[model samples]
Target: MSKILIISAVFAPEPVVSAKLSEDIANELALDYQVVVIAPKPTRPFGFDLQKDENNQTIYRLQNLDSYVFPESKLLGRLKESYSFGLACKKYISQNRKNIDLIYMNSWPIFSQYLIVKTAQKYKIKVVTHVQDVYPESLSNKIPRLSFILRFVFLPIDKFVLKNSFKIIAISNKMKTYLAKTRTLSESKIEVVQNWQNEASFTSYKQKENQDRRIFTYMYLGNIGPVAGVDLIIEAFAQASIPKSKLIIAGSGSKKEELKTFVVKSKIVNVEFLEVPDGKVPEIQGSADVMLLPIKKGAASSSIPSKLPAYMFSKKPIIGSLDIDSATAKVIVESNCGWVVEAENVAELANKMKLSFKSTKGSLLEKGENGFEYAMKNLSKKNNLSQVTNIIKNALL
Candidate 1:
């Protein structure tokens, strides 16, 4: 069997979206190809040691400043970590060039993806680039003052990599359209392979007949970052007039403490913050009366959150605060799984929350079932895995 080297900035044990997806990809490919994963050591809030699985696939974890659970969130520290991982990955590929037949990578830590893709091209190895999130676009949105300069410098580099790769896999059609328009690449060169969640991992927890109907729980699970619109969620929850409803913020990130402080200072009594216990995500999701999926307005065009599938699998209606035209909003609307409100509009969000709380259990269950059926039919793990593996096989041929 030919060898396939997979590179990602994060991997299993990290509790990040990229990590889970990358781990699943490696395991799936291992059954047909010799697979090796190159990643940085697992760190924070889920610090798991480097591990190698029984399939004999090797995992090479390089040293970086992210040795601790929460590294300094400075720009320089992030660059150092990215460059270090890039250098380590390049060295490994250089030494093992003759043994590797294909390179599979995600768009993360931009420098690492650039280094590995450039190196693979030089060595005449086949490469499949998975476009998880649009880079300079995401970067530009975050720093408006430097947007022009960042795009000027990085767009060409991004074009070069995408142009030379054997195939570009976009996680969403919106992403593919963005790349095609901005990078001037052929739409045919990019294929859509939406992310999938393991349905089995999210078995629905049936509520008891006597379960409390007095309190409605609205849950938000995932990173608490700027782009996540978490502050908006908190503000809306605080303003909503649902006295019997509770908002659960279960996850960690740079803004976790800031958010907690905000709640304390504002005396927001209806919202609660909790750490998600390992292996309890499904149960937690199932217990909620409604799920909150919020994204900042500007970021809606380039990426879709990896949490959507899991949310759907939990069989609960969603209250999505996102760009009305965003792919995320499109999914929620098309599936008829939930309601959508303008992102960042605190008043609108508050009204939506109140509406969800007043919704009958039967109505919520119907919407949740719609989402679950959509997920099972279109975002099934088995289908997505097979699709990705076939794309890799075709690229190798």
Candidate 2:
């Protein structure tokens, strides 16, 4: 059996942002390959201690990277922490390289990729880099000086790794185009494996429950991060004067307090932001009549929110505030699964929101039903695993 080692900076049992996708792919790959995962321990937003070693043991292999530089970092603390994590990973991999045949690293801390690159080269193992967000495209433009430093040092290394890697998996087509522009690699070396949802997560199918509710509820699940366009969605919902309609925004983030401040300052009465209980994301989604996916303009090309599959699973019509050409927009429009609007366009979003609520009484339910059917037909975890396995097979050839 091929032994594959997966490295991620953040992971399971903590409800951390990237864990779901990492865990899902790792678990799926485990069906065919022996999988081992490396991840950091949990901490608070401002870096406080939390439950350690309590992560969900089912899906993740869970090796704790113990360094205070991580969960304790403020401002440039992540840079310091990630550098340490990279060093630790390199040391760990160097010591344990004999057991692994291939390496796959998720990019966020970016240093994880760096460690994989270093170790894979030493061990002469194939390495695949899975990008959830684009680097220079997102962060480079945000902070120019830092971006210059990154472009000077990291970007070239990233390009080298991408070119030399056995495979590069992009979460979106736009990201693939971006990488293709910079890297001299065969088209076959690059693949777009969009994010996926677990088939079992759709518990609605397993045991029937009454989904019929009187109130026309709209829900937004996932991070309250700025890039997610949570503020814009609230503004749009504020403008939407639809009576008796409640909007529930679930999940937490760095901007949670700031977003709460905005709601309080603006007196947006209809919108409620709740800290959703971990693993109960479906419970919140199922409670809604419709779902809203709002992404701000100029966020990042790797902007296909992972929540898309969850929204689709909810079987509620989604009104996505994403650019027309964006990955999420393509998914919504192509699947005929939901509606897409330009980011931060409150008027347009409000209009679509009103329309979804008004129209779902009749054929709108049919639209949601269509979305669920499409999700089952196309976006199942099995299909994702098949795609990943096919890519691995092709790369091996």
Candidate 3:
């Protein structure tokens, strides 16, 4: 059997994007491969809890590993955590090197890839790096001084790993291009494989009671991260003219406090924020009249938010505030399932919100139907799994 070792920062039970992607890929690969994951045990972002791993079997079998303090917490903590993760991964690889064929890992906890590469070298194993989000540059670009440090410290190492890898998977074309220019990666080394959603599970559902009382329920579901343009949504939603329309922003992240501050200062009576249980996304998201997907103006447009397929499957009209070149924008335009707003144009976003609230539900529903059809045809997880397996097979051969 082909033996593959997967390393990631998150896995099942966490409900984060990295976890979902890792779990899905491993599960799919298990059909014809022996997959063992090595993932950092889950912990509260602030606290250090080691006991959480003892309670969950699903998380344990899938390769549970020690959790180190997050880097952003402190300089020493970051260095210690990076070293510990690298060492822990090295120790694990030492024990199982003979059984594994290839090492695969995602980008966040950027240093984890270091372990994968080091261990791969020790065992003469192949390596594949998954670029979930544009990294080093992403972290550094958001903080300019760090840009200099990351360009020197992180970017070169990232490029080295990618160059040595047998294949580097990019989530979007733009990501592929950017990585190529930044890293000077060989054109043949990069592969574009857009993340697919579990469409079967995203099927349209019956609208729940009280769904009609709200003028238009505009929802922004998923992580409230800096790159997602949640601040833009908040600013635009705060000044939106649709007094009866309600904007429900769900999920939590580093930006939650800032959002709360905006809500308090703007006194946007029509907007509400909720700490949504990860499992409750379907019900919460499905209740919305429209789903919002916004990307920050200057952020990498290569990413198509994981929420798009869910929005499509939810059968809700989407309002994407992204550049025309973004994968999300292209999908929305081609599917004719939603409207696109300029990334930084708050006025345009507000107008879209007003227009969306006033638009006929039938036309919106029709657009959603078209989107669902397009998704069904092009973005099924099953199809994606097949494609991924093919890539792995080709790489291995």
Candidate 4:
């Protein structure tokens, strides 16, 4: 069997959404290909170093300057981590260039991809790039004032990777479209492979009959960051007049403390914060009467939240606060799984929350079922992973 090297910034034992997905792909490919994974040492929220050897693959963890806890607000720390991983990856590929048959990479720590791809090109190795988000553009969205300079400096490098890669995989069609148009690449070069949920692990929870109709729970699960609009959720929840309803914000991010501070300063009584253990995600999600999906207006165009799949699996109706034309809103609307309002509109979001609070359990359950069916039909792991494997095989040919 040919040897395959997978490079990802995050992997198993890291408490991030992409880690699980990356782990699944590496393990699956190991059944046919001689697989090796090069990732950072276990750090951040979930920190447990793994044995180097696994069933059909070998994992190599490189030491880096990244903190045990993610430093979301520190640009210098992030750059140090990215560059460290990049240098390590470059050295590994340089020494093992001859043995590797194909290079598979995740698009993150942009510096790492630039280094690895450049090195791979020299070795004449075929590369398949999996794009989780469109960079420079995604970064630009967050910092509009710096966008022009960012595009000037980073766009060329982005184009080089796109133009030189054997194949490019995007997690969503919206992402593919954005990349193709911005990079001026052919649509045919990019393929869409939606993320899949582990149905076995994320089995839906049993619904409990509401003993107290007066107290409804609205929950948001996933990162609490500017892009995620946790503050928007708080602001809207605070403004809403749902006397018997409560809002629960679960998960951690760079903005988690900032959000908590805001809640305390504003004297918001209805909202509660919870630290969700990874194993308990399904349970927490299922327990909610409705799920809150909020995204900043600027970020909606380039990326879809990773939590969408889990939320779908939870079989809970979504109250999506996103741009009307965003890919996320499109999914919620098309699946008929939930309601949508314009992002960042405090009044509108508050109104939606109140409406969901008043909705009957039957109506919410029906919507949740619609979402679950959509997930099974279109986002099944078997189908999506088959697409990925087929692409890899074809690239090898």
Candidate 5:
């Protein structure tokens, strides 16, 4: 069998979207191709007891993410990490160049992708890039002061990665369009394939409905990083101050302690914080009356959050604090599962929270069911897996 090397920032057993997608893809591809993965040691939400092997694949677990992903710093850390991972994978590709038929890149942008694409060219290997985010632009949002410099220095590398890819898989049509317009990529080169969750896992698990009937809960789950805007959510939840309503912030990140400090200083008592252990998504999602999906003002203009599908599968109505034009906001509106408010607008988010609390149970349930139905039809893992696999397989052919 021909061999395929998968380069991903995260992989199996890591409970993030990319990890799950990469893991699923690896499993699917292993049926006919010898699969190998190069990924960081699993140190995402938390540290993992590393697994160096899989059933039908080889896993090259490099340095732990803690060594590279410096949450305390700014863009410099990301640049360094990307370069480090890029060079490491470059060395591996050079040694195994003869065996690598194709490289399915779901890794970082600019430096890492450029290095990978360059190495692929030298080895006469085909490359299919799975884009999770539009970089340089995303980086610009982070450091607006140096936006010009970031774009000037890194944008061309990003273009090279896209230009050289045999095919590009974008997670949403919005992303595909954005890449085409911004990166000047050809429409035919970019294919839309959604990031999917295994809905069957929800079927196997029973949702515990043991909450107090009088109280309304709004919950946020996932990373609390720089662009997560959890502080904004906390402040809005406090401003709403709906009697018998509470906001539960679940999951850990670099800013968790700072957020807790802010809450304590502000005397925000209606908000609660807890760490979400892995495999507890169903439990946490089931417990919430409304899911809170918040992204910073410009953080997610084209991409949908991985949690959105899982949130829908849990059958909970959503309230998204995001830009009206964003892909996530569009989904909330289109799916009829949620409401959208301008991101970073505290008063608007507060009003939305209050409205959600005052809404009738029937109205909320209807919306939740609407999202579930949409996810069933549009976000099926099997369908998306086959689409992505075919895109790669066809590219190789």
Candidate 6:
């Protein structure tokens, strides 16, 4: 079997979208190919761990890196982590060049990605890049202080790596188009494969009775990190102050404590914070009446959140606070499953919350059905995963 190397920033034990994707792809590919993975030990949401970690297998090479966890070192720390992981990948590839048939990387951009690709080329190894979020521009949302100057330097290195990669998998068409146009790359170079979630996982969602006695509940699940705009969600929910309605913010990230502080200080009575243990996704999702999808300004131009598929699969209406032209906003409109307000606009978000709260049960259910139908037709996991694995197999043949 041809050996494939999977280099990711995080892996299975890390309970995040990217880590799950990395795990799925690795296990799937392992059936027909010799698969090896190079990833940091579980360290994202601060508390996840893999206790029985073994490093002796030739099929697995896990690394211990200096990556910062949530509520810890912010920007400079991430840069250090990225550089640190990049060196790990580079060293491994340099030592195992003859054994690696191809590399599939879902990792931090600019530093980590560049170093791996640059070194891989020396030995004629092909790399397939999985694009999650567009960087440099997205950096403006993360670290505005140096984005302007850094873009000038980062762009060229970015262009070189992407342009040299054997294949690029962009999660949405809007992102694919944006990359092609802005980077002056060939249209055929990038393929669109959504970071698909397993529909079967949600099939277990039963028609359960609502646990909360509130008239309506809105939920924001997943990371509470910088780009999540979770702060915006908290503020909007507080401002809406809808009677008989409550907001549930679930999952972990860097911004949790600050958001908790904001909620308490603002005297937001109806909002709640949670630490969602694994295996409770369907239950947590099935409880909500509407899904709150909020992204900060300029951040949604290139990518869709991994949560969108889950929200849609749960048959819940979404109220997206995203850019008008963003891929995510377009999906919400086209599916007619939710409402879209201006990204980062507190007033607009509040108004939409009120509107959704007042919507009739029939109207909300109809919207939920619309989103489920859309996910079925467009985001099928089997089809998308086959596309990804085929891209890898054909690259070698």
lDDT of 1 by residue, 1-397 (tens): 8888888777766677777777788877888788888777665443223344446434442222232122435555765766677777788889889988998887354676777888888899988998887877777877789899888987787788788888999988888988999888899999898888878777545533325667788899987777788999889988885888888998877788888999999988878887776567887776688999999877867567877888998888999998898888889999999999987898999999888887788999999999999988877786787788788888888
Return the TM-score for each candidate structure. 0.92, 0.87, 0.89, 0.91, 0.94, 0.93
- How many backbone overlaps does candidate 5 show? 0
| Pairs in steric clash, model 3 | none
* TM-score ranking, high to low: 5, 6, 1, 4, 3, 2
- Summarize candidate 6's per-residue lDDT along 198-262 as a digit string, tens digits: 87788656857677656689899988877789989888888888999889998887788888998
Q: Relative to the unseen true structure, what is the C-alpha lDDT of residue 299 in candidate 2, on a scale of 0 to 100?
A: 67
- List where candidate 5 sits over 4 angstroms from the true fold: 46-73
**Over 4 Å off in model 2, which ranges?**
31-33, 43-60, 68-75, 141-153, 203-214, 300-303, 390-397
Model 2, TM vs. native? 0.87
Query: In terms of TM-score, how similar is model 4 to the real structure?
Result: 0.91
Per-residue lDDT over 1-397 for candidate 3, one digit per residue giving the tens place of the 0 to 100 score: 8788888766666656666778787877777778888876564232212233355444214766675746233445655676677777888889989888987777344576776686787678888788877767666646777778877887767776787788888888888988899889886888888788776556545547445765678899877767678888878887785767788988766677788888888777778887766456667877788899988765656777778887887888999998878778989999999999888799999899888887887888898898888878766786766776667767777
The TM-score of candidate 3 is 0.89
Best by lDDT: 5
- CA lDDT, candidate 1, residue 155: 77
How many steric clashes between backbone atoms does each model show? 1, 0, 0, 0, 0, 0
Write model 2 residue lDDT over 274-393, tens digit each, in one string.
776665677777677778888777665455666787778777788988777777788788778778888778899999888886783656677677777877776667677568656654
Cα deviation of 52, candidate 5, in Å:
9.6
Q: State which candidate has the highest TM-score.
A: 5
Candidate 1 vs 5: which has more TM-score: 5
For candidate 1, the 10 contiguous residues with the lowest summed lDDT are: 61-70
- Candidate 3 has its poorest 10 consecutive residues by lDDT at 44-53
List the RMSD of every prediction in angstroms.
3.1, 3.3, 3.2, 3.1, 2.6, 2.6
Model 4, position 223, has a per-residue lDDT of 73
Poorly placed runs, candidate 3 (over 4 Å) = 44-60, 71-83, 107-109, 207-210
Give the Å shift of residue 270 in candidate 1: 2.5
Candidates sorted by lDDT, descending order? 5, 6, 1, 4, 3, 2
